[model samples]
Target: MVSWYDPLVLAQTGVRSIISATIGSQADRRLLDALAAPKVEPSDFSVDAAGRPREELWLDYVADMGDGWDSTYTIAQTVSRPTLTLKDETGTTHETRGGEVLVFGGDEVYPTASVGEYEERTVKPWTAAMRGQRPAPHLFAIPGNHDWYDGLVSFMRLFCQGRHPAGWETHQRRSYFAVKLPHGWWLIGTDMQLESDLDEPQVHYFQEIAKRMREEDRIILCLAEPAWLVAQVRAPKERSYLNNNLDFLEEQVFGKKVSVFLTGDIHHYRRHANAEGRQKIIAGGGGAFLHPTHVPRKESELAEGFTQRKTFPAAEESRRLCWRTLGFVGHNPKFGVLTGLLYLLLSWMQVADLREGGTVTWNLGRVLGAALVNPGVILLSALLVLGLIGFADARFGRGRWVAGVLHGCAHLAGALLAFWAAFAISGAVLPLGSVPQQLLGAVLVFAVGFLLGPTLMGLYLLLSLNGFGAHPNEAFSALAIPDWKNFLRLRIDKDGRLWLYPIGIRRVPRAWKPGETAREPEWVADDKDATPPELIEPPIVIGLLHPH
Candidate 1:
């Protein structure tokens, strides 16, 4: 059974383990320094008397991947939270308990390889709650696109161990590594750097590992970004080298049968059956921003034995529209004045209709049809976004929108489109007379207006609301609940890979006091759905150790 844990905690532990390994006998000394190191500490937060946090951070989901992290590893952790179960082809169901050995998919930090960045953004918040947790599971990690943002200096210093003299430059002992588990299970991890010709050593190294796996019953291949998933969405040239149909190498080079392939990167959750009918899962939903939502496509659905869960049953609110501030068109006289163009685009159908026709033509029937025909595209784009949002929110608290104008717009659009499609099809059965033609046009207009009207209204409201305050003034208020008892819950999209809602994670608990808002233990399936240990901020790394 594959058990997933919090990504941030996994990254923190990986950094801790690597540093501990690198410092060797001085591991204790280095740890002492890390604990005592003086640094800027982000403020501790709590909900107001009404059960809402005074401050909440806005996080952007990762989309533009870079060279990627050095390595990705998947392990299990044993926490008091709960357990989830996954059944193999043999009808053997394995339960995944919380707080198991953590897995690392890659790009634990962002923009730079600075230890401070990782510690501040990921570690500090994570370790705060697990302070005295015992028997922390072993850690494994892989490189992601962003980890290479600063030449991977921060990653190497924080996570590498058992290295060669040439250091990480050599392929044989780079980021890719393995761990033999108690069962016949073998944990195989890899680095996404292979796309930039960073896998020569890893490829060779894995060949030997795969050969050894020939004798195992199942192999858990770890990846920062799901390599197969990328192959499904990316152009052939844009595909990562790590995904060079390496599974084919199993029979040819390793003389073994590969069972499961694992990956992360998009900060979501996904599980599928590979070409060989083996299981492939994407479990990146550790402590990161929830990804956007998407519908599944056809090729992905058509793949032999392919099954995806796009929407969760519980998160009906997700069916609403999400308002994203695209860009601010300021008056820059130095450049060609473009603010005037915004008004023109909104008013003129010829200019905006085709450009945004994708949305205009975005009928649910059409989208689902497209998904049935081309699941690959859907898998690449929307599924990633939807899975990320659904799973992340299930574990952590952050995403929730007001059921207002935005939702009204989405609902209106979907309804109108359904009516339009139904009526338009009636023309074939009924006579194609004046009545049919007029009805078609009317349906089309209704659909258009239903979708666009609320969107336009929402824009107007935002504009008005923003104008209500002066520059540097904020209009949006915190929506946090002061008590854990008041916490809202959400689910994943149905018809996607997971094909379940709330994706098996438990409901978020409400806060204790009216003015005190904090997350209770997650409702994992095990431990009778016990409470999470404690509430603390994540860790932050402040320094780096260069080449050994």
Candidate 2:
């Protein structure tokens, strides 16, 4: 099991954070890459497909792909993406074009905050994916938070090195990069520096790219995190490096010529659009724990110029969106069970009494009093109930108290509900002649609460109604919690119409047996359920882009 407290991981992250702070991530890249780094690892690269340049470009994009590659997270955390990738490679992708340019949006590995993990998680698998292609497509990548965890050490090595891995070329040297497509299409991808903010150097780097762009250049922007995550405060600018830089790129670089905004972080697929028809696509389903796509957001609208375009299992409302992929996943329940046991042990240790006669007595109230002992519980609970006024009071648009209240109440409610249910059920299982039936009831309650560990925590975090980074972002996640795992296929046809396909996962393509060609997966999607080979064009605000 991968413990977050693993000595090596903590040591690497702690050390890397200090180093990154002192010198910045990119400068360190330049220094460490002196021997192999190119003099000019550009912010963008211009590409012509098939040696005959066409204005239109075709590309495939995916992100959040570092988890589950080898079941390294079986007992440590959730593992889904790697298996999903295998499914895609082996079968799910049989019907789609793999794109001439396969861009790895970001996040090469999970818990990948260390350089030591990149090779095992990202380099080996992705290189094989690229190299195994009949005529390998060009591979480009950006650094996600996980990649940044190592200060971009492993990211630069895999993508910046001149040599081909498994024969697939990765030509960029820096974390942020762009690919100049034909016609007026430009694919600009940025790196969200640590804590989701871009530093001064990163700002200047994009500024240079912006200065070189034409007033009329249309951009296909890539961001590490989705801009529309917080439905309440969607200004196209969140208080983060990625969002701030996106603003600069629009205001300064291409002069607001952004045509398509693509991102992957939320571990599900969503196509958000505004009334004007500008598209913001979230296709984080490359391989990770599935995030739900809640239908009706508490926010009247998700955000300014943002609305859910389309999602699978299109149910409405957040409450209906809970219980995400409850089963049918390979997640190990051992760690969760262990956690439950730990909670029970702690509760027992805190309240168990030993008498001189070697008798033991249980104080149930004391056992659960970690919560009741808090002086602020009543104030916080009242604040949570009254804070609903903020929903009515436009004057106090948002405040920390509102968030804290909502979170506290939700947690309390979940705990109470869980404890009550467990006590009721466990109490029923006891004999009436028991010396103290409440003791057994209390132990069972503790067991149930801990066993439902994440479930309770997820409930608490989910109730943060502020919509400002709610743990599961009630908007995109809440109900109809399907494993909306997927990737995006963006193709600009010969006539320059851009087609965006959100390919939802069926199953990881089954592994090929001996003597099998990579032509198809062992099990293909049934025709009725199969995603159409060619995607329909999404409505765009700026100009007409249609298939010929």
Candidate 3:
């Protein structure tokens, strides 16, 4: 369990300073450029004091929407271990002093978010983390792609008041809701399923919210997935939010210098500069599986500097704020390579002493002679060896060739070991017909049956589970295990810039521009073809996502 990484990072004299020297100033240029864009044509788009789109009105007035409410609250209340703290970028501990809201990205349950999924996988762990915690944060969330797998009913019920014990619904509103925060902060939450259109009622609700923002002083938007991050990672291939013209909302609100966005789902934390000098925080790493660390694309940075697309330079400036900090930090702890090597060495030592440790001695010469004379035992052993090898190959191997070889060896070795053990035990014991002898025979047979059945069953499952004509790669690929507990958390800062703090790492990547990574959806043939959707009705109200 020796850790090598601890010293490696500690040896550096603050890599942040080194990285900054190599890069330039961290100011956002995009926000400055955007301020020069045309002024808000309020008449062209009917908006309320809040500046929310008018087509989306019903959602604007939800119990959560207001100057000081957060409909979607994202809480990283749980820790992977007993020692970790559930804190925010400001080191505000959430273990007891709960925030008012919570948000989710996707895969709330590891692989898929099936109905009642949380009951089996996450609810207990989450509850354990909050046991006796003083205050509890209200929860709100949106459906990510993983959440969409089982149609989100399970997720909706767990958070929305449909089930209990095995459920986590703390309120009555559907999974996604908007809450108005104090001091003109309007928190808008929504599903990231861009393919589906917002229902007419919901659309109107959001529009009315936009109208209100026009009159408001500030707004923060909370979304499960950081559409900005997705745009950077999967540029030219929009994930969800970006596909729905959320970028356009950024452009409209850029001059306001008051809107901030809070997002999660990438499983990494990031802080980026908004074109209007606001902060965009990505708090996606909260006990969940970590994602690849990313750098801003060169094209994005060159096209619009650090404004819309946050570049590394902007991150350097972000760190100077001093309010940012991590709730927790961890490493794999055990060096996997070293651990594997030690285990292998121990296994080798055990195998070397196997013959000497066991008090059994076999008359191999006589047995071989007998086997040569009859040949049946040898033939049976050969067949068993082949089966054992096949099983071994499946269990230990990776690709087709290695897997086949290992399985074949395993089957052979298992049969030989069983035969030898049974033979030695039989030779040392009494003949059958006695009470003790019969009992021993029964027990031995049962043990052998138990061991052999699994070998046989495993081979059968391997063969039968794969559909005809399916590639072995595809069949075996899915059999690989996946980590079920990848919890991520996100939070937004006061400046509207995002600060992403992964639970495992203290250093975060530099933020990218809003549109630098913005990609036109696949449905849109190309970037040029990806025009803002034409509005037929009175401008739909879309509330700005509030930073929690």
Candidate 4:
């Protein structure tokens, strides 16, 4: 229900982003350490039905959720099911039960993190899905950047406490956690607050965890951001810090034991593997807006020794979706209203009366000249250009400024042209009254501006993304497509093999009706055309690759 294109949402998020960068930078990490809770021991999660250490585990991973209700609930419904039977790409049927442990990788709430947003967007849907389940899964989460906007006070209170958000039990004491899986496997979730380096306390916590690991132990490291993919897209100087932090943790604390890296910041599903069989995956498509997988291109190598193995919504399909940006005004009508108002303001400021031979006419030249001399108009124009520049992603480096300036100019040019066309039309058809001509021109400019403004922006975003690999986040967030949601289900069997099942929801339900019973989900998909979850690919099995 929340559109990223909404002007209010954009404004609020912009302010939060600024505050988090300035004030939060100095205090958040230190506060995290100061309030660090008692760490959860691996033994707490390793127990089996017999109350002894187990040799196998089943867990579910989802992230970047807590957005629109329909999309978020659709994912929650599928994951909360007692069991799911899905056919892989080869038409072979595979059955998987709901995970015993549910891990939310990052960005549990979108736009901004707050108790109300978390309750409505996350808790309401998840709890509805598990209304009367007998044995509920345990919940764990790592804070993403959005969660850190409020210095993680809300996130920690909602998730770190041992409260049950749904039927699921919360057990993690800190923002970061370590869980001992069966068969010498460990699942570690790290909170890299706002892309900063790992806090000292976190490093020490993982160091203590390392002391308990056996030589043959393997780790499934959960990160808030996919630093590997980030390193590929960012400038050279900006790339190394996050990657270096992970490298240090791997080499020193964990002794190079991480066999799989799991993250969800990018909002899609992608798998990459190294020659050594270390797997890196991005499965952030829990419920947030879909992010295109075609970016950074298929040929751009992500990390050293790593090659991309698979991507959901194939690169070609992703490219095709970029074309949908042409429907920006249709998709985001309220945003169009904002653009329309801006155009009206500009048009009103430039309106000039020209009288010759007892006839009044609206002239494009006079209107433009008047606008140039107006101080308010100039200030507004400058702000518009600067705002667009600021909107550019820093990852684009210097090209961002160029893209911003050009994009702003295009909007300005389009507006002027709309004004010219409106003035000419009114002058040709209407009588020579100055007030009537100006009024009609203003209305026409607003109508045309609303349509043309966002349309121009959409075209700019589409061209930038497909042409230069820029604005990957901005381009797609504008569309807010609710489809192609995905999550991961993993099983570490008694034999110590890790089985990964990447589940995809091609289309989320758009309508919902009340459930028939108390045990059923409070809301069920009302549309008979709802699509069932499917396997993205064949089940991926990782055999023991670490040296004994």
Q: Which candidate gets the maximum lDDT versus the true structure?
A: 4
lDDT of 4 by residue, 1-548 (tens): 56889999989997988888676667765445435664536535667767897777889999999988878999998998888999998999999989999999999998898898899899988888776543678888999999988778788888877777776788787888888888888999998887557877788788888899899988999999888888877776657778787888788889778988999999889998877878899999889998998888744566568888889889898889998998999988988999998888876666543345775545767667766888877888889999899987675687888878998888877777787788788877776456787688788999998899999989988998888888888789888988899999999987888899999988899999899988888888998777899999988888876411
TM-score of each: 0.44, 0.66, 0.42, 0.94
In model 2, the worst 10-residue window by lDDT is: 72-81
Which regions of candidate 2 fall more than 4 Å away from where they truly are? 1-52, 69-96, 114-116, 127-133, 199-205, 231-243, 274-277, 295-306, 312-321, 324-338, 347-455, 458-469, 473-482, 506-548
List the RMSD of every prediction in angstroms: 20.7, 8.3, 20.3, 2.3
The candidate maximizing TM-score is 4
**Candidate 1 C-alpha lDDT tens digits along 133-232:** 3323334456665565444556665555433211112111245566543223455666645233333344555566555543533455665665554555
Clashes of each: 91, 19, 124, 0
Put down candidate 3 lDDT per residue, 452-490, tens digits, no spaces: 533433443344223121122212222221111122332
Comparing candidate 1 with candidate 2, which one achieves the higher TM-score? 2
Q: Comparing 1 and 3 by lDDT, which wins?
A: 3
After TM-score superposition, what is the CA distance of residue 422 in candidate 4 from its true location, in Å? 1.9
Judge candidate 1 against the unseen true structure and give its global Cα lDDT, from 0 to 1. Answer: 0.35
Pairs of residues at least 3 apart in sequence or in different chains that clash in candidate 4: none
lDDT of 4 at 452: 94
The C-alpha stretches of model 1 lying farther than 4 A from their native spots are 1-100, 162-173, 194-198, 240-256, 274-277, 299-304, 309-548
Model 2 score (lDDT): 0.52
The Cα error of candidate 3 at residue 111, in Å, is 0.6
Select the stronger candidate by TM-score from 2 and 4: 4
